[model samples]
Target: MKKAALLSIAMLGLTACSQGVQTMTDRTASPCGDKPNCVSTQDNREKYQLAPFTLTANASLDNIEEVALKLPGAKTAVKEGGYLRIECTSRIMRFVDDLELKIDGRTLVVRSESRVGYSDFGVNRKRADQLREQLKQSGLIE
Candidate 1:
């Protein structure tokens, strides 16, 4: 009975940590939850809201894809049409965070959220800011 209970708990933990692509439409990314572990350009909440990237005339989804892949511990999980999802793993705890991007005309929508956590210590926000800086430096975003 104890073994069974332990196994069930282990399975639950694993499930909570599992990473998957969030649904994104043409100009919308998934909204962040009430938790402090998320930040998104689509979220209107003051705490979770972030400014969307302004894409230059020459900017392409491919350019965003390249810059996203350059982020530390980032791996492409899905890339279809104008939507891209990247999984970023923490070097210490291996906690996975989902970073999603959607190209909407001349704007780029972005979201970053932890897969399993109530508070991410501002990791998601920092990641989004880092991405913004990188994209700016690459002449991709305004």
Candidate 2:
């Protein structure tokens, strides 16, 4: 009877240990590997390349106030001699006309011109082919 009981306990322990094994979830670290705390716990960006933008600047107090009032999510981080720093973001990165639009506080403002038509300029160009080969190897610009 004791041998049977021991055998049953061993089997039960094995079953419990198997059930306790953890499975890895579908997730990855930051796709760009820049934002250390990014929640992109999986390699999700199979198509879109990761993009990031950051800037620091100094401007007059009056200009800082004006910028703050005009842009959504735009904030001054440093101030000295009537000047301040501006850090900003927006919900959308829109390329329009000659400028890109970014949010300041609750509005869009001109930022930069959108780049386009690389193939039009690159396809027959050796430099273009080189870039294409590089991107293909990097698993980008397919």
**Which candidate tops lDDT?**
1
TM-score of every model? 0.82, 0.21
**Candidate 1: tens digits of C-alpha lDDT, residues 1-142:** 9999999999989875665446533334567778899999999999999987899988888889899888989998888988888889989888888888888899998989887869999999999999999999999998
Count clashes in each candidate, considering only residues at least 3 apart in sequence or on different chains.
0, 12
Our tally of clashes for model 1 stands at 0
lDDT of 2 at 106: 26
lDDT of 2 by residue, 5-118 (tens): 999999977764542213322111223233222211122453222222112233223533453434443444334443333333333532111112232332222121112222
- Give the runs in model 2 whose Cα sits over 4 Å from its true position: 1-60, 92-142
